[model samples]
Target chain A: MENRTIKMTTPLTKEKIKDLNIGDIIELSGVIYTARDAAHNRIKENYENNRKQPIELEYQIIFYVGPTPAKPGKVIGSAAPTTSARMDKYVEMMLKQGITGMIGKGERADYVAELCREYGACYFLSIGGASAMIANQIKDVEVVAYEDLGTESIKRLKVEDLRLIVGIDSKGRTFQEEQVKKYKISK
Target chain B: MTRIMSTEDLIPVIAKLCMDACYHLSDNVIGALKAAYEKEESPYGRDTLKLLLDNAELASKEEMPVCHDTGMAVVMMEIGEQVSWVGKPLEEAVNDGVRKGYTEGYLRKSVYLDPLNRVNSGDNTPCVLHTEIVTGDKVKITVLPKGGGSENMGTFTNLVPADGVEGVKEFVLKSVLAAGGKACPPIVVGVGIGGTMDKTTLIAKKALLRPIGNRNPNQYYKELEEELLEEINKFGIGPLGMGGRVTALDVHIEYYPCHITSLPVAVNLQCHSVRQATIEL
Candidate 1:
């Protein structure tokens, strides 16, 4: 948990993710893919049925989000992280696909941290409900697949200086668990 | 003498309420967030609170939704007993307003046509509407756009009368802890005590509509609210559960008398982006 912010780019490697610790601040830039519950379900189904996935998952980052419709002249609408815990079941499946990074809000199941350690992946936390501020960091958006899914579609996002905190590191340490214990007062 | 009120007129007003509630968070919420920002002990938690305040300001200035999940429209209407309705059916008119508001306002369409089939309703129609007939000729409507993250974390349980207040407190603390960052803490906890099972959950959600600083009015309940708030903060769940001093902005309890055998309790958690609005005509 370093009190310093580190800058990182997309298509992250396991080596790059290995040293990152829970509670480290990150300024992430470059391409990431957005997928929420519906998109994940479709992705999993496609994998199960041996169909080609819409987006290549290897060495990629997945952000759990379902943004509102963009206004005229806007690239995207209020975009923020949905609860990550809801996507916990899909984590193992996603990690198996060679995903190195996961971003969203909330505390996840314990096994998610273990999976991160097992797969040498990292989980980042974005501030929940800070949609407008977070949306400002997104430079461009393209719906790469599942247009029928609307907001749940898998979109390629180009974000610049997107703020995030490491929720779980590759080592399996979780910031929420450590920090909550620190500040909790005995009854 | 009966006053004729047309349901047709409600569409535009409800539409505006929906947009306004989504775009601009109310003053009470803004104030509470600012206070939470000032008092938050954890640096990470404080920074999160600051971002939330900035997000609210940005969303209002741009006339965009404060959060992406614009939520299912929860409408509470108080209609005058002396009024007679004409024009479209009440439910249809309300859904029309929701559809218009979500579409025109550029908000997300989150509601599904059916739970099992899992098809998007597309227009965000078929709102959850609760109506009550009251004394005046005027009609009052409140639109609360409740996000899914917090709504999904809500809980309900029926306890034996012997369990009493201790049981209620224990249940509430457990619920909040279990919700953790998932419910998006620095949350407003709406606790419903007494009543039947369904009614308890309804009032629990309705309790969130109250101003953050306002107490339950009853001295005993007011004290309980204060106690719960203090205890919750002590849990260190903090903002977004990153951990800090102020886990909850407020605790509101709404209770009703129930049968002798049952003590039912429900808890509804509202995320920091509490968006709601009310109007009277």
Candidate 2:
């Protein structure tokens, strides 16, 4: 019914992530990592290869995006959010890596929500097709890892007032679960 | 007497049409979004609609394509039965249009030659062109640029006639709900029912070409569209599918009589940036 201003510090921790609720609209501020279908796979592969440690996520929001290459003198191109369901497979990997939140569009699978409950993480929906507008919120951008994937590559971004809505929260509520309850008529 | 359209003459028209559709949301689509926005009870859904409208205006003045996807070019041609092609051939002419439009407008080249290798097709050539012959003196061309996000969520199903209206409604709702925010709601759902498998799918896509807020000409189809729209909005997929009353802006259904045994249905979920324009020559 009402909105309150709060700062979302990146590299977030369990203690910090426990207080958020479902249906909250967050104006996220601080560092976040970007990845999508490909980068998520690569991160999983690094873990599979036992390559030191896969993404040491903490208090971080993973933005699911594969942006177009930046134009001349721009920090990024039209960087819109991709569908999040594609990253459903990597949620466990991310949760184990201690990711506290995610920023993307669309629904996460049921298993992903369970993992969020177990791991004290939350998922939020960023405005789809609003990449250029969202990009204006970014203060800095850098390649965190996996630079070879180009747009799909992992990048660390400094952002402020990046808007998102909680789709799944630590309390274990999800839009999918809610809708399935509302719509499932019978067997 | 057939008139040959020079490639040069056709290219600019296509180029301008493409640019115009990308920056400006068609009036019908705008009307649909506004209606959905006003009816939407969720604050987020309403804000999303405002963002979309604002995006449309900013894209126009700044000349940025509405959504970065820009999409693959789909050309629908109603060629006059009397007309014959000349010059560089029809396909080549269409490609030339894509080349000029994508290059000049600075649209993203999302087309790839090899699906697996992912090689950009340079100029976005080999457009998806669907042609039809109709009794007329003038040629009509309509371009519907389909973005990848929504295109990826399209689904097809073959059903028995026994499934009937309930079957049609179930398939439509399932497809949209499964797509959720992936298709970027509030979406416009295009449902094609009753034709053979392929035609059914084609009809679903063709349904999207119908102007926004326009119901099917068939009275039965019009009723079905209204019912489906109500059911879909009830899902609360909202704008961007984050839970709201405007999951779907409209439902456009096109049906064809089929063999008694078949009830093929296809759901083509078109994202809010439904960019389309037609040229009559």
Candidate 3:
């Protein structure tokens, strides 16, 4: 199937996320927040305690990444999505607070898929290990918090033409589940 | 007297090769990606492979890493029995090489002090160095910058000898199915059949350093690799497991003899990134 191109700028709205289909290609742009294993641990800490969180979740999109440091002249070093499953434990909190979109690679838990459907959210995937290609899409990056965590620091980024696909849409149509349905039986 | 090799001379060579391997996608890997792109039936899979090709090109041209996860440096040092070196211990030399390469190359430092402590080592060091002494006058160093996403999918099983090749085929297929996109499709499958559990895994990893698409020198293992490759590609997990025709770039098997009572199988999946390099001096 030919993929449809999309332009997404955060804060992502429920309407925007709902419009995506599983496997639609996206040429995402605009501001996005970055966090990974350590950052998520911190977020869950605040979430369960009813403390003020790091970044606002309302209408925001979080990308699961821990980028390498930028070289002398580069805007950002190679930046790519980590495994999404690592953050599956925290998906409910983010979804409950209205995080409309997520970007990462790999499959997530079944509950995360159900949550996306219930919350009008979407899960997007990029080319795994194509960090140099992904880095070219970022215009700027800054560590907004958690600098002590080194590469795992929470950061903000401005990106342009970052390519991705909807791995799981709001309706709960997921790339992985569908792929298994198609191929596992045929062979 | 054994021939003398300076530690300083080998250090820089190892450093340069480590850095270069991370930045440069070797020709064989690039060739395989290109071939997969052309042969892939699904548009998404093709696009993914194309982006990887572009990533490799950009990395080499810009002298940046192909992936943000520059990877844990696994260095294999094969020193000739006739050769001796005056300098830091071999492990220290390997670590020194990783230290310079990760820092100077602007690569990500991923070594951790402890699994639970979760503290970054600051500079990527304490290389997983494998040393061997063979009959020669030279030293050969091979570096594999292994990524975590794919490394997490590696599995080893001790099947009784009765399970045999059919059992192995089942395990290989099932492992790829379970790994799906998590290990990254269009992956290089490295299989080590026989040996002890740990030895099987090491040889499985060593299998990855062989050029992609090359056959095992042994006729029996070569045929097994070919059959496994065919079975894996038929899974329809395409690139990134999104659905397509190609699931594996190649399946490589390396084997050693084991006791009559047991068969040990180790499967190591390397993502499409496929970073590796070798230098002989």
The models' CA-based lDDT, in order, is: 0.93, 0.78, 0.87
Model 2 residue A2 CA deviation (Å) reads: 3.5
Q: Which consecutive 10 residues in model 2 chain B have the weakest lDDT in total?
A: B1-10
* lDDT of candidate 2 over B1-281, digit per residue (tens): 76655655677787777777666677787787778778877666678888887777666666666776678888888888877666777777788887788777766666778888765676667689898999966788888888878989999988887888998899988999889778998788999987788899889999999887888888988999999888877776677875576788789999888997788999998998888889899
Question: On residues B1-281, what C-alpha lDDT tens digit does candidate 1 reach at each position?
Answer: 79998989999999999999999998899999999999998988888999999999999999999999899999999999989999999999999999999999999999989998989989998899999999979899999998999999999999998998999999999999899889988999999999999889999999999999999999999999999999999998899999999899999999999999999999999999889989998
Model 1 lDDT at residue A183: 88
| Fnat of each candidate | 0.81, 0.26, 0.63
Off by over 4 Å in 2: A1-3, A52-59, A69-74, A142-150, A175-187, B117-125
TM-score of 3: 0.97
Q: After superposing candidate 1 on the true structure, give the runs of residues whose Cα lies further than 4 Å from its correct spot.
A: none
lDDT score of residue B23 within candidate 1:
93
The digit string of per-residue lDDT tens for model 3 on B210-250 reads: 89989999998899999989888878888887777888999
Alpha carbon lDDT at B103, candidate 3: 89
Judged by lDDT against the true structure, how good is candidate 2?
A: 0.78
Clashes of 3: 0
Top-down DockQ ranking? 1, 3, 2
lDDT tens digits, residues A95-185, model 1? 9999999999999999999999999999999998999889999999999999999999999999999999999999999999999998899
Model 3 lDDT per residue over A78-110, tens place: 989988998999898888877888899988888
User: How good is the docking of model 3, by CAPRI class?
Assistant: medium
Error of 2 at B193 (Å): 1.7
